[model samples]
Target: MAPKAQTPSKGSKKAVTKTSKGSTAGKTEKKHKRRRKETYSIYIYKVLKQVHPDTGISSKAMSIMNSFVNDIFERIAAEASRLSHYN
Candidate 1:
């Protein structure tokens, strides 16, 4: 046979307390805001389509080409800035 459980009397009060472990208080997280990058405009795509009516380029190819061109320009600009003060 199981013993009966005891219940607290109505005259007594129960208290609940929570304790912090102090782990996150000393450390602060730094949030970095990303800068919006400039990209090729829709007008350029319209002009490209007008220039080559039957071009067999897919959207995926265009995306790859766009990123490659952007990377090249960024590198060239960096090199130019680095060499600007040399001569």
Candidate 2:
């Protein structure tokens, strides 16, 4: 004869079971702070200096390069944002 399995009584502590879908009753959700992004001009200047140690970039040329890079970056960012919104 097979042995019978014992069932927990109504008041028994062992009757409680952990759920597959977990509870989040007491936990608070954390909001992460957004970090400020640094410009690529510093890196660009460094590379230019490394490539041409003897030659020098004029202030006006450097300014133009920085603005050009910024415009391209802004356009890329705008496109990504638009795609994400649609998706």
Q: Residue 56 CA error for candidate 2 (Å)? A: 1.0
CA lDDT of every candidate: 0.62, 0.70
- Checking candidate 1 for backbone clashes, the offending pairs are none
lDDT of 2 by residue, 1-87 (tens): 223333344324443432222233225444467998766667778988899877778788877888889999999999999999997
Model 1, span 18-78: residue lDDT tens: 1132334335544468998666645447667899876556678677777877889899999
User: Worst ten-residue run, lDDT, model 1?
Assistant: 10-19
- What are the per-model C-alpha RMSD values against the true structure? 15.6, 19.2
TM-score each candidate. Answer: 0.43, 0.49
lDDT of candidate 2 at residue 12, scale 0 to 100: 43
